[model samples]
Target: MRNLDLTTLRSFVAVAEQGGVTRAAAALNLTQSAVSMQLKRLEELLGQDLLDRSNRRIALTNSGELLLTYARRLVELNDEAVGRLTDDVYEGELILGAPYDVIYPVVPQVLKRFNALCPRVKVQLRSSTSLKLLESLRRGEVDLILTTEEAPGQGGETLTEMPLRWVGAQGGLSWKRKPLKLAFCNVCIFRAGVLRKLDDAGIEWEMAVDSDDDRSVEALISADLAVGALLEDSVPPQLEAIQSCGALPDLGIQKINMYGADSRKEVLGELADMLRQGFAASRGPVAVPKALTA
Candidate 1:
């Protein structure tokens, strides 16, 4: 009979999520050599190599990918169990606001880690456009918010910056349409800037989809009925970035900003830390978990 160790699994998951042993070690507050050894031990136990060391950056082998899916769940459950049993529990709801497109590649993972630490905290996620979310934050409707905009305005801090890309359904031809058919939700922060860029570049366009609902815009884009703007990493699996290739004008890099970071600082400490880690992870392609984009 054999058993898996939670400590080693934690190290493995950190390494996967952090994109390297060094970053993973920093995240876990463990020495680099210690994280490396745990990864080595896990590989020995599983009888398979988990990390591909061929490149400068670490990448998961197929076996590594398979193991990661289970590891995250196991570690999350373990933490939740411990936190629920040992910690002074906080029981309340947290109203969170975030733009729909920026939800991926960060928010979901942050929710998991936050939930584990504060098992009783019901994280109420409010998805809306950045400006609306900021308004919600100011109105005290949301506890904290994540926004994607050209830059953070007053009372907001930038988490990470990512280039906005022209996104469309796989092999979509909407970009080629004369008077380009654009699809974006009514209040999207990117919409106005995108339109300006198109006009400045002399690309004539019309709103093919202009519903206030995100799904309507996404549906039209995904069906190849129109094209839209999305963050570089948050683009859905069914979509691919349309190559500008001197055809479409480029949008500026957008910043993911956090609002109301100081409010309830003590209560949201764990969640804020997790969000920082999650956003930092988005900088590297290797750190992105499937759950993020999915």
Candidate 2:
């Protein structure tokens, strides 16, 4: 009986998802020729043309569509089987630190999935500003940390760049008021961008709340006390992204990054992959960022 290569299926899936071979190659950390070769080999094995390349963009043939469905299932099942079979029975405590903003919504999902994969590993979470989290990592108080870079290309393994936007209370006119009232942490990455832009735009601003607790900042915004800046996706339901409020500077994008004392730890590696996967699922199939690939 002929056998199918899981590696070929993976390459096909990457090509399909990325919408082109070049991007798929970059995403897979494979050369263009290598990806093309994988696809060619897979097509040859099945005795069918999987992709229709008549136009500038490639589309899937009828057979390719059918194969994609099975490919995805096969890949998922194979991954599950491998994980179940090869996973080390690990028992240890992992200390994870991240900004309060990341703790909500995002990190929780990562933790839930990680717990399922490594039930014996206990994760102790610490929430603070990115600056504080970095300090904790440096001081050997935390095993791993997720943080936003203060400047472009500054620190940690960058996962992805997230847009920073101004957020204010729902149905509130706080953004319209001059001398903007802001609520953010003292060491927040967005704070400097917010301040710099506001200054450049000739808009006056004051810190209505300066706490590292994201809940406190949310509370301030919910009460219409001040506008805050946060990653566009991380903005809570109580707050609405305020982009058109006049003279507000574009806060730009910040890199979401991970830092750890030891990336080689079994538990930490798995947890990091889970975190990256969670974030990637939200943003579409993302290549594990280069820094963490090692």
Candidate 3:
């Protein structure tokens, strides 16, 4: 029998987990035909059908089920080996992911310091919504993720909890309007908390702008289109805190977290500690910087 290739095994596993070629292809960023071809090659090498296509719904045959168990174990071991070997490279790459709103302002300085401390380590940074970052982490695409504690999805260790507050354009509208206009990211935890509090208080509110990027939200607020809730540290200087809005009902604070594969426990732990200390130092009560709290 020809030896099964890792690529083929990975494709097969993706299909099995996703339950369809189209979905697996999308998940793996491969064409459907390519995924099918890999599966065929894998079956040919193993000399047994891995999926029962006789039925409308795909099901693993007895032999296929057994092979899947071994395939998954092999893939996991392969990944672990790769991680270990790469760690030994000294010039190893660290893939880091985070939401832009939380990291954009501070990441450059953090990266510079990290590089100076571990000059041999190469870092690649990606910015996206917390949900997307967590998805990438689960798929083993990213080695580390830093996200708000209120992130909807699971997985990750809490590193720090940052305060969130309500803010708006200086001299903007009053809060008595029913359904206050609010600017926020559609999936933001801080936004969700704000909404929940409004609902509980029976205060109607409308989404002035549902955006994923902080820059867009900032623009809306700057234009005085609507008020916004943001991390205490993230509010830009042109805005003023609407303390009269009632403490944002204590959005319970948002925590920052770090996540990675199980094998990365040691390194992730170290990074998390460094991040916690940095955040604490940066958060001293300095009358919110003028740039952030005009």
Best by lDDT, which number? Answer: 1
Candidate 3's residue-wise lDDT over 110-186, tens digit each?
57545544555778989887778878888989888888866424556675567777788877664445558888877
Question: lDDT of all predictions, in order shown?
Answer: 0.81, 0.75, 0.68
Name the lDDT value of residue 20 in candidate 2. 62
At residue 155, give the lDDT of candidate 2: 41
Per-candidate TM-scores read: 0.80, 0.68, 0.59
Of the two candidates 1 and 2, the one with more favorable TM-score, higher being better, is: 1
The ten-residue window of minimal lDDT in model 2 covers: 285-294
Cα-based lDDT at residue 111, candidate 1: 88
- The lowest-lDDT stretch of 10 consecutive residues in candidate 3 is 285-294
Instruction: State in Å the error of residue 272, model 2.
Output: 5.4
Writing each residue's lDDT as its tens digit, candidate 2 over 73-166 gives 8876776665566556656899998876666556886786576566667899987788787777778899988887745233467666678888
Better of 1 and 2 by lDDT: 1
Off by over 4 Å in 3: 1-89, 104-106, 151-155, 174-176, 245-248, 265-270, 286-294
Better of 1 and 3 by TM-score: 1
Report the number of clashing residue pairs per model.
0, 0, 6
lDDT of 1 by residue, 125-202 (tens): 998888898888887898888998888899888888989999999998988888799898888888899999988998
Q: Is candidate 2 or candidate 3 better by TM-score?
A: 2
**Global local distance difference test of model 1:** 0.81
